[model samples]
Target: MADEITVTVVDDHPAMLVGIEQWYAAAPEPLRVAASGATSKTAWLPPGDAADVVVFDLQLAGQTTPAFGELRRLVDAGRNVIVYTMRDDEQTALTCLDLGAVTFLTKTEGADHLVSATLAAARDRPYTPPALAGALSANTSSDRPKLSIREEEVLVEWFQSESRDLVAQRLNLSPKTVTTYLDRVRLKYANAGRPARSKAALVARAIQDGLISVDDL
Candidate 1:
């Protein structure tokens, strides 16, 4: 299907993999689990590389704790990853978002949230699941990206506007200048170790820094 959202699922549990595949198969929209594996190598190395979105389980079978290394590798490679795990805490969710995951979802969020998040990730669109929104709201850390006034203006306007052109028109600046400001904003976030590669990720960053609220969207 032309509009089909292709997914690469990576989970350690065989039963969980089966369940996820079933969820994708029965999704309301055109969705496909193009590939799945029990580990990073088996799941994302070959066939999974071409998938539109990667549904990843943070805690794999072998190692203890969440696998931030693998997650970092994927994000650094410019892959849109959704960290699906059983852990449902504000810190963990915030950590994943800061590391550049497209979004974070707990396994308990179920099929509806999972499918919606997958679709949003595949299309490079914004999606904030309830858990993530809660996390963003609960976050009180002082850590933030140090953006210039112009950069913040452009960033906030871009978030409110549908497109960069609209932002430029509203600000009375050239489209190229608007793009430059946004690029600088992303760079500042990246330099602060809070990568914002997607609009959704940037939105998450803005929320974390208290520059915007969930209601602002």
Candidate 2:
């Protein structure tokens, strides 16, 4: 978290673009807005493409609906995406999470949450704001990946612990074993049609499946 986390912001509103840059600049943490744009098309190029994380607005300029396509594209390209939009509905939040967003945040959550989420996303760590936690708790979808008892234990410990090596030490297992268990968990999620490649995504899946809670993180 000590390192300056680079960010790319994509929002249709000119005021929002400027506001986010100001917020990042004024934040106590090292969050630099490397690039910004009114659309995802331009944001996915150059500086934006190389940013540590991307803060995306779900509703863009010319879209009548939430920009799921843009979000999916970024996630598929292995970019860490945080959906910073005005849409606060549980379904929208869950949909973005399922699409592999690092986390979903509403603009009204303020700069603190934005800064925190950006930092966490840059490290592929989990940071659940109030809105995202509410969405996870309200989620009623029963689509959960089946996990072995060991895999489940490792996943929860990994979420609570700082690193996999710490989890291995706590469980008296090797680091490689811890990683194997985590990989299995991820495989199960992918087989269930839900991909959990990043730690934040895994945390969201764990919460939705009742394996862990926001309070645990």
**TM-score of candidate 2 to 2 decimals:** 0.69
lDDT of 2 by residue, 1-217 (tens): 5588888889878898788888888888788888888899656789878888999999987789999988888888888899999998989987887788877888878878788788868866556655765565455578855556676677667655536688899899998777666544543433354454564455565567555557744
Off by over 4 Å in 2: 144-193, 199-217
Error of 1 at 3 (Å): 2.5
Mark the 10 consecutive residues where model 1 has the least summed lDDT: 182-191
Q: Which lDDT values do the candidates have, in the order given?
A: 0.74, 0.74
Off by over 4 Å in 1: 144-193, 199-217
- Per-residue accuracy of model 1 over 1-217 as CA lDDT, tens digit each: 7888888889989898788889888988888888888887754567789888999999988789899889988887778899999898889987887888877888877888799889868865445555665565455678755556676666667645536688789889998777656544443433455544664555565566555567745
Error of 1 at 99 (Å): 0.5
Error of 1 at 19 (Å): 1.2
* lDDT of the structure predicted as candidate 2: 0.74
Model 1, residue 209: what's the lDDT?
54
